[model samples]
Target: MSIAQIIGSRHVLAVQNLHASINYYIDQLGFSLVWQIEGWALVQRDSISIMLGECQDDISAHETNNHSYFAYIEVTDIDSLHQEFTHNNVEFVSQLATKDWGQREFAIKTIDGHRIMFGQELLF
Candidate 1:
């Protein structure tokens, strides 16, 4: 694919605590804050950008997640990412392992209970 064929991507997530969520993404995952105001913040790590909005609705994170992942991010080195998050004491839903589809994968629940899976394609 050419550069014009693909654009950037962003994921909007509802977080219960604005400050805490921003801090988690910045400090834990090494994401840099692009901008923040009122109840919204935009953070980025490399080419990926995620928007976190504070939610006041009458719904819990457990209800929001409900056994569903919020997003799937492709990573270059899944093991290094898992190790980095693990070093930060991040809680994981699944330890790193190759899936049945032949991709190395792992899952971690964010502070707001957003489950994000990271994986890399296996050439073999």
Candidate 2:
């Protein structure tokens, strides 16, 4: 079987405020702490992981397009995740909607302005 060639991938993000960024990932975004060094941290949510590193300049998620080149999390249940985030007052770049490409998706911004888009495949 030709499975996904990519076994796993981690996005190393630049974070100006390490602790606060860690807190936002852990507390707000529901990611659990994996481990941390003085200037870096690792957090995970299910199968996905992120590496946050302390930096002088953390770039914005988007430079031109409405959204591009950001982390895309393929989840099992998009509606439930959306509801949970909504209840927690998490900011969203857009509401949950099925795109022409046949995936239901939504996007959110992290404390350091990193954008994460969550999606679920449409069987239909």
In terms of TM-score, which candidate is strongest?
1
Instruction: Report how far off residue 7 is in candidate 1 (Å).
Output: 1.2
**RMSD (Cα, Å) of candidate 2?**
3.4
Query: lDDT tens string, model 2, 48-112?
Result: 88998898564554442554436888998899999988887788988999999999999987766
Query: In model 1, which regions exceed 4 Å deviation?
Result: 1-6
Question: In model 2, how large is the Cα lDDT of residue 43?
Answer: 94
Q: What are the per-residue Cα lDDT tens digits for candidate 1 across 11-77?
A: 9888888899999999998899999999999999998899999996746465865554777899898
Task: Report the number of the highest-lDDT candidate.
Answer: 1
- Report the poorest 10 consecutive residues by lDDT, candidate 1: 58-67
Error of 2 at 116 (Å): 1.1
Backbone clashes for every candidate come to: 0, 0
For model 2, the stretches where C-alpha displacement exceeds 4 angstroms are 1-6, 57-69
